[model samples]
Target chain A: MNPSAQHQDAEGARLGMWLFLFSELLMFGGLFVVFAVYLQRYPAQFADAGRQLSLFFGTGNTVLLLTSSLTVALAFEALRQNRQRLCQGLLGFTILAAGLFLVNKGLEWHAKFQHDLYPGSQTLRQAPAGQELFFGLYYLTTGLHGLHVIFGGVILSWVLVQVRQGRIIATRPTMLENGALYWHLVDVIWIFIFPLYYLLL
Target chain B: MGKVIQMGEYFRRGFLEPSGKQPALFDWIFSTDHKRIGLLYLYSICTFFAVGATIGLLIRLELIAPGRTIVGPQIYNALFTLHGVIMIFLFIIPGVPAAFGNFLLPLQIGARDVAFPRLNLLSWWLYIFGAIMALSALFGGGGAPDTGWTFYLPFAGETTTNVSLAVFGVFVLGFSSILTGLNFITTIHRMRAPGMTWSRLPLFIWSLYATAWVQVLATPILAITLVLILSERVLGLGLFDAARGGDPLMYQHLFWIYSHPAVYIMVLPPMGVVSEIIPVFARRPIFGYWFVAASSIAIAAAGSLVWGHHMFVSGMSDTAVLVFSLLTFIVAIPSAVKVFNWVATLYGGSIRLDAPMLFALTFVLLFSIGGLTGLILGSAATNVHVHDTHFVVGHFHYTMFGGGGFAFFAALHYWFPKFFGRMYNNRRATWAWGTMVIGFNLLYFSMMVVGMHGMPRRYYDYLPQFTHLNQIATIGSWILALGMALMAVNLLIALRRGQHVGANPWEAATLEWTVASPPPPENFEELPQVSHGPYDLKRAGEA
Candidate 1:
């Protein structure tokens, strides 16, 4: 009848979540390998393509994700201390940071589209082979990381709702803890991505 | 299902019995019971395996003669591709673990269910959905993908077929696998009953433990690889296209990075099955238990590093090739250690020549032949000679079918009575085993022989010189098919009206047999306090 029944183990949930996160990281790890390989192959052209990205937007988004990571951790800590209101507010801020990060990403992509710098565009078609692949990797890695940010926001938002409803409390904080861990991973990935894509010098 | 109306007196409501609130179909689909989920996988994969096997038989038939046998080249290409996709992802990869592992893991470790039961159900649903998406690619608008299951680009990217949809399906399947692995790892780590230490655990659980790790760690790479293929297909990204400044070898590297460890995910549980069955049938503590357990983990760890062997003839660095070849050879040592341990397990004990034992014994033979040939292919020099040949094909089937596939059947027969509370005709089961072994060896071994004589694999047709052996292999397909059909019929008959069995029909000393046959809805009426190891032969006297 009951699915979990009497088998609830918070430590088990944490272990499961951690293992799931490992899989998530390894997915990105594969992309990093591909990115590293291509960067090796076309170092000069990749730098040229990297310069085409607005460094200002890249830096701004990196800061936004880092701040959001902090907020999520603080939110998790607040939940443990039973400061539900502070936890909710911090989670809301984290979600807001996620939204701003996406907006910045959108504006940056629009700028590239205006320049015909995206994959499959005529401008990219005419570009050198290596630069075409460079933009390709750029869009792929950043786009995937963006998706994770969206997913992370949803998770943190869910935890916020659950905490407000008393479903997630100090006595049972696995959901909040795992949600924060996921958000942190999103930030951690962007930390690699910011330098890997933008700060290539 | 047994549906044994006559055994109403002994019929205890199993996890098989649907909860009373809803329709039976709805109850089964939505139920979080791990045993039910395991059966769901068993049924779904059996259907997929039938489709894959039929396609394989046709492929063998087309190769029976020279050019223009049953289908033309395009159709033949679709045939082999579909066969490989279905068998590898849908059937063999999920075969032992998803079916037997889900059913037995909780029962073996003395848990009510997996660590996450709802998550377990979700994994099954994802598996079914992904299997649908994969199969639907055939009938969908773009026609069947012919880039092969590997889907190596730029062909995969450029193909007008449903490569995108098919790969997206596999991507979803990768998630299913990862979740299953995550669930098993958690269940093992946290849900072991009191006193069920790691060493006292069954070898099958150990193998599943190793397999779950590979599944969690390695399958995500496959997911990412497939996603990259989707990007290339949909966005015209040339990440894997060499002409667009992308390296084709990069795709190979990524694919095998996951796909190679996947071989362990496929075989290790069956090795666990053999390990579990051998000691029980031999009536002895497993010879070198520590060595056998450690070897499963050793195989998993070593298997991941050897993916480059698959890429040797596809063009790779000489130094990378040398290192991968060495690692490939080294991976075999753990497997050999397992084989010798199983043999040593069978030695000098009061061994029963039952059907499960028969299949387990043949698994050692077939897997060894397959594994030994793998070493030959693992060598840089020999691999260059037979890289894409039928020898490689034969070796794969030997390990996959003869090893994993046979052990799956052995597990079915081994645990069939325990799960169904009924026993199949053992003589007929032994006959089925005999038929399958003959057909399996005749089919795969001939391919190895013909492959050694220079027959390239996956060809729709062959030269006049390669015709006879191809015909023999095709005939071997028929025998294999017959054997499979007989085995299926035998099990079906047993399900309907086999002799009712009690708990511990095999007299094997394990936690599962200590409970009622078909088991109670919650596995144990009371939690078991484990003091003895699973196979304490002195404790397990005559039946």
Candidate 2:
């Protein structure tokens, strides 16, 4: 939303971001469809696989992502009120939350790998028919979501820099708003993902 | 290298208006101008088109006889696979939308540039890079993939032919497509000039709008699908491979879910192209404008639901097949509505069979044949009979090549005056159109005929019974190639030495024609205010 010498449309920028977020939702939506079909085919196996995942890490990452969404929205509001310091602090907090989410995910995957439960492992292949697919969908959905968190962090960090330089102040918050929108999408996908993968049991 | 010396600055200025600070080639590459970026896409897409077409000719020649005529089985397999990938991903999918749409969308909508101009340049770059990555799979690592463009599962998972990189290339291409859709949607929503209401918009923009939605909503599914392919290879996930206990049918479901709508993304813009040209050459207000406009969106929506038709023979449930077959039949209505409308528009008017008109009319004929044959293939019984046969191959070629490909050629002829401010030799263009159509119909129609007679597709060798049709199709490919060469040469000559034209050479009533033949750097000297219907014969200039 920075006021360029040329005309700018903050509203148009927001629309573009929302459209992009729709793509992200559908991308994950595809995996959800795959997961749903497999769940129907091997419901008991999928539920058993669900119970195998560490609930503590899943819950922790879920909470972390939900809270990160809040901080980003607040950051957008603070940018609007010209509280540059609070905006930067809140944005930084959002990225830190993303980092923590990835850490929790890494720990969960590491625990699985230690037990030979990851995709393509002999143990996973030897397990029940549907369980390997469950783990496959599990890693694919969460891993892609992790990539999003990383991307969200990078986008927010850029916005933070722009805010720090006074380029993204109250009168020009399009960049921050778009970044926040992206972060919120990452959170929303995790919300669907956590329920399907961790809570279905 | 692209420098074609122009007589006036207006024509050159539109494309050469250095939007970036860089010099020469870099300037063009880095340009954020919609016009320049469109030309960038035009050049790159054409080069890819030539490569793909030549490969196609070779494939046809190899299939001319029962046994291998040129390449070995492996290389022949590679040739057709690359041809399909190149033609589908690199050429036809981006055909009209990337090149002409970029150049014309802003011009028609009365905008200086797309809503996200810098992002427009990024889409073209992504396109080029994705194309390179996809092509590199042929020369680098293992060898050219014979997995086909669909990259069907289990086999794609098992194949050692650099399938991952090729799939990854398409994933990147999907991003480019999604971004372009986002930009076009935003620009249409927020950048239309005052009084340029939705109904007043040209049908081409409407087609692009519908196309953008399909691109945004459907392509991401493909992105994920391709990512799964990479996952299967790199991370050894093997979600769709049977040996790993993964369901193979799921791969078909996911791929077609995106790809069926992808058919719309490929053909819809050309439907838009035909819509624009019909009224222009017919010199008549389009019959049933609202119906034509609504049908573009209708085709897009209905097209999405019919992905299951592709799965009918994959052992899906009878109820599922019934529903999908019904939806496939239903989707044809909208397209039929469009074809009827085009014919009606031409019925009571002074029609000019210019080069563009000739191609557009042929598109109507070819697309009609294609769409009707699609009904035969869509019927569960008939479709199962011809599932992976040459009939299926012929069906798609008719729809994609004859329908979309011809419309792209029509758009090229239609817009050449506006794009270059010059005219090609019309006589040569007609001869080219004739040869291409004759060749195109002969090539594809025989495939459909032999396909019905039970010749399987993608077979390197054919039985003696299918030899005559195969030979005919081979000859057709030669003629098609000759016509393509003639058209390319004719247009290239016009780029430099042709006679110049005025603002409205064909007297089109769209906003684009109201500007200088080659539009200014900023499309309009003053932003246009629309006060009349786009096709009003009485209205020449803006209010």
Recovered fraction of real interface contacts per model: 0.77, 0.71
Cα lDDT for residue B150, model 1?
93
Candidate 2's displacement at residue B290, Å, is: 0.4
Interface RMSD for each candidate model? 1.2, 3.2
* DockQ of candidate 2, scored on C-alphas against the true complex (2 decimals): 0.60
Across residues B209-253, which tens digit of lDDT does each residue of candidate 1 receive?
999999999999999999899898888888887777889999999
Reference-based lDDT, residue B64, model 1? 88
TM-score of chain A of 2: 0.95
Off by over 4 Å in 2: A1-6, B1-14, B17-22, B541-543
Which 10 consecutive residues of model 1 chain B have the lowest summed lDDT? B1-10
Model 1 alpha-carbon miss at residue A34, Å: 0.9
Native contacts present in candidate 1, fraction: 0.77
Q: Give TM per candidate.
A: 0.98, 0.97
